[model samples]
Target: MSSPDVPSMTGVHVVVMGVSGSGKSTVAAALAERLTLPFGEGDEFHGERNRALMAAGVPLTDADRAPWLLAVRDWMSAQAPTGSVVACSALRRAYRDVLRGALGDVLFLEVDVPAAVLRARMSARTEHFMPVSLLDSQLATLEPLAADEPGARVDGSASPAAVVEACLAAVRLRCDA
Candidate 1:
């Protein structure tokens, strides 16, 4: 679906979420550019403690993520008047709920990929703090968004451009509804 056909975001917040290596940041960036919205990388909100833990190849507990999620929520809330796209590894339902509390009209775009593919991507990636060893824990903690949730799921195996297209199509469909 083309942009014009989608509900015009007089003001709507979109979140792109997935586990590590699922291309949330990449897809969010492209979507933000295409939609002419501001982009926020969720990783940037990670506190120093969380960053240190992840850098040491340790998986974060939910407590470790709460503050980070709240910060992102605040950012999203602040951007509601202008609209924004945020890239977050919102691996659990509660996390999504927290975000929804701040931005009621939030739309989640989930990037889905197999663990094996994600592992491969993590292994090949450089300069990223998230380690391959933490992938299993993330997968374990993940609670996928229900179908009734205002969201779209895109296969991460496709090229980035294709994934972006799929995301746009899903967003358009949801907005049109």
Candidate 2:
């Protein structure tokens, strides 16, 4: 469990989560850079088959997502002692639970954004394997952070800098508690 102290002083671990194009990577990387913590991109942990399935516009089933989620969770667990920030879709409560169990009470930074904005961002990106077509399924699968969760929901419609600032403020407040 994280102590109620400044995260930077206490080595807090955070997961920046959202559907594809919600700016999870951008905001998480910025936040990590600001906090001087190690950063990991969730997509990079996907297996070739998973990436291929997503690239083909197929929505991943829970069965298909399990291994990848466990990988991300393990990475987060490994980073815990040193503190880190990770960008993961973490679209379901079960997924977040896996992470929580691994990290033992980590903070989740949900990058909540409008559907239109998400579509626009997905359309603009060309290098990522996730197609805009899968956004609906992703959204459908997404379970927003609950009130009891140890984290904050951030507005992803804002600039990345703004989003990172908001995340920092929210996490700091949580840490201060």
Best by TM-score: 1
lDDT of each: 0.89, 0.88
Off by over 4 Å in 2: 1-6, 9-11
Task: Give a tens-digit lDDT track for model 2, residues 2-92.
Answer: 3333365234678999999999999999988877778999999999999999999999999999999889888877877777889998999
TM-scores, one per candidate = 0.95, 0.94
Q: lDDT tens string, model 1, 29-57?
A: 99988888889999999999999999998
RMSD of each: 1.9, 2.9
Deviation (Å) of 17 in candidate 1:
0.6
Candidate 1 TM-score over all chains jointly: 0.95
Q: Cα deviation of 70 in candidate 2 (Å)?
A: 0.9
